[model samples]
Target chain A: MTFSLARPSTIVEALRLLADDTEGPTAPLAGGTDLLLDLDDGRSTARRLVSLDKLPWKTLAWDGPRLNVGATLPLARLGSDATVRARLPGLSEGVDAVGSLALRHRATLGGNLGRAAPASDLLPILLAVDATVRLVGTAGRRELPVARFLRGSRQVDLAKDELIESVSIPEARLSTYVWQRVRPANDVSQVGVAVARSGSSASWRLALGGVLPVPTRIPEAEVHLTEERPRPEDVELAANAAATHARFVTDKRASEAYRRRLVATLVRRAVARAQIPPGER
Target chain B: MTSEVALTVNGAAPRRLAVPDSERLLDTLRWRLGLKGTKEGCRTGDCGACTVLVDGETTLSCLTLTHEVQDRAVTTVEGIAEDPEGRRVLAAFAAEDALQCGYCTPGFVVSLTGIRKELGASAPDSAVIEALQGNLCRCTGYLAIVRAVARIGNGNP
Candidate 1:
């Protein structure tokens, strides 16, 4: 029979429980959306659970250059946070698009980041904003870039005994982008794209979820598209570069050919949208 | 092998119990609490059939832990008629004939209730879409359902 442990209050207390080696294969429980389901279905690799229910880490703050969002902050809070809505609206919009209202209220930023699903909405947005994840372990705390932290689908750079403390988004140039996708209602994603521009330098952070082994970033495509915008030759070159970099495997949800086509179409539109001002929308 | 969890279900005070770690919140609600109104169709979070309002937000009970909900408020389908705001959405669902099979109705109702409550007076069309994105309904194709719930805030159907 499986068992659960519920500890009340404080991040330090939660961290101690999470880092407890004596607990024996313990997994930290945040929203319990993904982890609990896995456990119910007998698919869980977890032996013990350290609940973060009362952890005092639910806050969203802006400190000029960086926006410090507690890992426990839920999607609803992220979507509605005035600072997020004003500064990093892309990240806010991404969080708003995740799951349903109920899930959003319960699903935490840490859980989503920890789960590290390529289909994770906030991740693609975080990549655009260049956010960093703060992970707390028994020894101390450390930071990892969002782009690098996500090692693969449902995987992260988190050590076995570490817990994600929070995610910080450093302020960037005032830029606009678009998140365009075609998916069944509440379904993960067929093709999701996030692109941005900084100074004269434009960048595209294209994430293909439910399409590849992990959220793959096509810098080659991004370079081609940003350097030579709208030129037919450049567009084709960029699209091909994206397809070359995108290692799409056929999933039950979608095909590699369909995803490739989406990448081409979405990359073009994302670039065009980024060129427009925010007020235009 | 077992642990006790305390929770507030549908406006009542917290009720405490001990169960095996493997038991889901949905199972505990039905088998233990006897609140049979919250139905379970898909054991996974994919289907909205097992939806409930946890801390006034809609979530899949089947995918939630009984222990995690300690001291949290859970609004189930049975409680919809009792809540003044929730009743409005429920009434809208009823007046529009928004349900066919009715199996997915409770989850839809709870989800809509959460949407109606969260968005309040200024919920834009996009906000409404985002709020209800997680729910899946085969009966209405969600048009009538959306139309029914959309009328609540703007007071225009």
Candidate 2:
């Protein structure tokens, strides 16, 4: 509640402000929906905030099949984009599942991935779609797979002077995000499942969320999805493998046993949802 | 780190004032400007009680930093009547008697007004209802609120 805010219009100034520790650790403020709550409640120890609002990172670009989203673009803007909705349905589903319309209006993809909360609804889809995170710092700009960029909850592969520049999805996929929660909006998922398939390859990519540490892919389950449309038996096998594979979280909000059951059910539903024909869906 | 900030509110001339760096827009509206119409139910973004429009987009004032919206147009429930769409939404809520405790009414009305701006007046009733998922109404069980949304969707509110 007693931190100085720095709104640098350029990336260099923002990095310099973040690197200057004389004022104490500066947390980058993307949308501030989660960070503000953490700072106000003493959960975060940041003594300074570098607002990304002024930076020219609120961009969304599509080059052919690849889509690049600037780190500060709001989740609402991403979800409302017609091409994003059409090409990456699962990503849209994940964006919509984050919070209410008001909250989504301010939440950003960079903030979501930077926080890397275990129960984040966005990560599963990001992993399913094989998104890549681009970062810039004293070491210069580097790109890493989202699977490698995330270290742990409240942890990322970002240095003190580093900033997330953009996230790139290599190509669009047939994908969907499915989860169960007490409430549809602003509630953490008990178990989140995302399934995606490349246009060229019928092989499905699967990821499980609401797990401890980080959301991860389940290659063991994906093998069961052999055809464009998987059979009921293979889907059941895939779901069972998914449930058995994920490291479900043991938070007070959900029982570990219940989470396992939800994972299996959600995995089945997500696979079915992802494999639906485009026009039929 | 107090700084001089300037922003427009309620269709008025830009108000320039000194504000603390960590001040939230919700606090600035309630305490600094005395615009108590924007209630603070949850300091977090879960409750939409602090909903307002920043540059014509629905925003959660609780999660938004005052400095983040510098020089932007802000419209609160106090200024809801200034816009024709907002006025219609407010009148519809009153006609439907959409509130009991009334604590959540302002947020619902503001959110509906924002929906009108985003989706236009002819947006479907289902879409408007889905958009209200952010708002919580302990009293009236959302029956009256649904009626209000229905009235707006009918383009008669």
Candidate 3:
């Protein structure tokens, strides 16, 4: 029943608010789609929630090389932006599928990544697009690759006095890709496989939620697909390795065995769909 | 612990008050604003029964803090008909028999209005369905709801 709310109008002010508060569990609130749920359910340890909507941190801009998405940019804007939809179709599609339109309209890409949920729709795409997170703290701004930014499920590398400012996605023509998954009857994702292929480098970005602790990527599975048609046997081997790498767990929604089975099937389907020419659709 | 939370509610400025830090926007709307049209079916974001529009974006009022929405514009189902597009959406919902139990209707109406306003003529059927995935309607099926919005927006039966 006790919580401190801090609203800052500028990024520097927000950073200072985070840096100065050394007293309790702290979390930055963007849209509150995820963090508020955790708090209400007693799953979060946040006692001091720093509201970021007051700051000038919701702008979306392109600096000619990278797309600088403010930490507070809602998921709706990310998905609806024409430039994003055309340039990063995979990311746009992923954000579009995050929740109901209402949730997406309020959920922020930074908040989604900051939550680090294995089933987070945006994480795999971020990994596939080579996105980086910019964190501001007392020491100044530092950038970390999306892969390294997420520490684990529900955990991040953000210090007590730090906040993610924006995520910079390098401008890259997203080759054909597919993000297919199985969700519970309620549209909650069970297992997700995000695949992206460059001109010659076909990469499979695998991320599973509901049956694992956090979103995971299998480098071997991705690297193995760079060559000719991947045989089912090859995919099976890669799926097992990826599942093992993810430390697949048995959760109420899906068992580890079922998840493993899905890994193989989803990986194969994702790769096949990724090879489909963009204009064909 | 008292804070002055001010925002434009339904195109009108209401008397700002000092609310406790623990109050959420959903509770504030129901208890303070007395706008009972915004139902609180679930305190969590999983259910869209508590959906509202903040700064023209559909958001789960249950999850948003009242203080966080200060200086923003809030549009609830009650306030939706103030605009031409909103009137069309509401009329369509009524014409389609979209509500049975009616508890989730207001949220759906607000959400659909927001989507149609944003998508205009370019929004597809798949996009409409995806936009409404969060809203749960246990009654009247979804045909009427979908048909109402589609008919109003597209001018086709």
Measured by lDDT, the strongest candidate is: 2
Cα lDDT tens digits, model 3, B1-157, are 6688776799996558788765788888899889999989877777788889888778889888888878889999889999677788788887788888899999998887787777775778767766777888867468888788678757653
lDDT of 3 by residue, A158-261 (tens): 88678888999865444233333454223556677766543434544444444356766678666565544567777666666666666676766577787777
lDDT tens per residue, model 2, A69-89:
999999989988878878888
TM-score-wise, the better of 1 and 3 is 3
Is model 1 an incorrect, acceptable, medium or high docking prediction? medium
The alpha-carbon deviation from the true structure for residue A87 of candidate 2, after best TM-score superposition, in angstroms, is 0.7
Q: How high is the DockQ of candidate 2?
A: 0.86
Model 1 regions lying over 4 Å from their true place: A21-23, A172-182, A199-211, A225-236, A277-280, B122-126, B141-143, B150-157
Query: Best DockQ goes to which candidate?
Result: 2
Candidate 1's residue-wise lDDT over B60-120, tens digit each?
A: 8887877777778988888877777778777778777787788888888888777777777
lDDT of candidate 1 over A44-100, digit per residue (tens): 767778777677678788886688988887777887776655566566657756766
Arrange candidates, best TM-score first. 2, 3, 1
lDDT winner between candidates 1 and 2: 2
Each model's lDDT comes to: 0.72, 0.87, 0.74
Worst 10 residues of 2 chain A by lDDT: A272-281
TM-score of each: 0.89, 0.98, 0.91
CAPRI-wise, candidate 3 is medium
B-chain TM-score of model 3: 0.93
Better of 2 and 3 by TM-score: 2
